[model samples]
Target: MNAAEVVKSLLVQRFGIPSAHLNAETPLRSLRLDSLALEELRVLLEEQLDIDLEEVSLTPRNTVGQLVAAVDGVAA
Candidate 1:
């Protein structure tokens, strides 16, 4: 899976997010991802995508599209 797919997969499987509710414009907070969950997601993304996210500034206000773009940036 690509970064977007991997991200959505992780959110759905690990975070117990309903896939139907996910979309590019959806904010992390809308998904109920708290700060701790965001950190855990960062770790999971880094592991699954094998890319460092140290430089990426993540916040619950960021959109799913934004997170995917950040991952794609690092992966690229």
Candidate 2:
């Protein structure tokens, strides 16, 4: 799967978010993800996408589209 798919799947399976509830405009904070959760997500993204996100800023305020772009940016 691509970065977007990877991100969506992770949010659903690992975070227990409903798949149908996910969309590009969905805010991370709306999912109730705290900083710790975001950090764990970063680790999982790194493992799945095989990319480093240390330079990418992650915040609960960031939207899912932003997350996907960040991952895709590094994965590319």
- The candidate maximizing lDDT is 1
Q: What's the TM-score of each model vs. the native?
A: 0.97, 0.97
lDDT against true structure, model 1: 0.95
Model 1 worst lDDT run, 10 consecutive residues: 48-57
Error of model 1, residue 64, in angstroms:
0.3
Query: What are the root-mean-square deviations of the candidates from the true structure over C-alphas?
Result: 0.5, 0.6
lDDT of 1 at 62: 99
Candidate 1 segments whose C-alpha is farther than 4 A from its true place: none
Q: lDDT tens string, model 2, 13-76? A: 9999998888999999999999999999999999987889999999999999999999988888
- Total clashes in model 1, counting residue pairs 3 or more apart in sequence or in different chains: 0
**Candidate 2 Cα outliers beyond 4 Å, as residue runs:** none
Q: Between which residue pairs do clashes occur in model 1?
A: none
Q: Score candidate 2 by TM-score against the native.
A: 0.97
